[model samples]
Target: MDEEQDPSGIAPLLMAIAQQDQQSFEQLYRLTSAKLFGICKRMLVQSSDAEDVLQEVYLTVWAKASQFDAQRGKPDTWLTTIARSKCIDRLRLGGVDRHTDLIDLDQLPEPEKIDPVEFASDKQRLDNCLSNLQNQHRTVIRTAFLDGCTYHDLAARTGVPLGTMKSWIRRGLMSLKACLEK
Candidate 1:
């Protein structure tokens, strides 16, 4: 079993958290916050939003830690699940108002048209950079960005764990950034 699934370690910490032990809560936060934050950051796409989601995750943990059952899953998995849910909730709430304010296209200034040759060159370069990524990375990045899928949607479509899906997108973005920079 992976360290995450090892109940002997995490179970005790969680039990302590359930009992409202501040030190144990601190220890739990110290152990799992980075991984949880990474999940939030990947799903939310804004560091400030991710930070808010992370805080909400901990608050939920504080209230619901007593309900966590070790037999059901690992502590890390439990924590990450909460983080993912919080991030998705925030995403949905934020997206609700996104289309409410409409700018009239007729009233707006005209966009500058790009030169076709330059556009083609940029597109080709981007395609080349994307092609450099691993198949999994490329697929996740494209599905998430190009196709406008959320992390939740991508995980459901791919049948992968939400955390794994987030990792794929995050690593894919980093690889793309490096390749594009070169």
Candidate 2:
């Protein structure tokens, strides 16, 4: 199995990292860096900026390893949150003009077509699972994940507390996972 999917392995690595173990830190980086880098690249347009932010993310992870609570969430989720926050921070600081970097849809190459039969089957399963979620959960999950709204932004827009927003999303995701696994 891929180590990236093994949360059990990561929990121990995080524990060792909390104690300032360099080898464990490197191992953790190897297991998760590609995923985190993709998150950085998605949020920040420039590859150089993404690389810089990714380094900063690892630094933050190293410093804040003790703050991680395995009982509260998965290691990848914690890592992803840190990476995403760092990217947002870089954007907020005006390192890049996000609006100026927008792609012209007309100039983009056409995407490859896929088999509609397979696509519709997977999409139908996802839609069915999403429909099983609570109304608030469904809305929050779609807005947060699909629309790329941050939890803080979602909370503010909906007039709910940040922790409550997070709980709703977490519960929604857990329900979706269980439903999809069937």
Query: How many pairs collide in each candidate, listed in order?
Result: 0, 0
Report lDDT (CA) for all predictions.
Answer: 0.71, 0.75
Worst 10 residues of 2 by lDDT: 97-106
Regions more than 4 Å wrong, model 2: 1-8, 97-182
Candidate 1 has an lDDT of 0.71
Best by TM-score: 2
Window of ten residues with lowest summed lDDT in model 1: 96-105
Taking every candidate in turn, the Cα RMSD to the unseen true structure, in Å, is 14.5, 8.7
Write the residue-wise lDDT of candidate 1 on 1-182 in tens digits: 34435533667887888899889888888878887887777666667877888999999998889999988876766887888777767767765211122223234332234334434555566778877887777776765542236777777767778999899889989988998888
* Candidate 2 TM-score over all chains jointly: 0.58
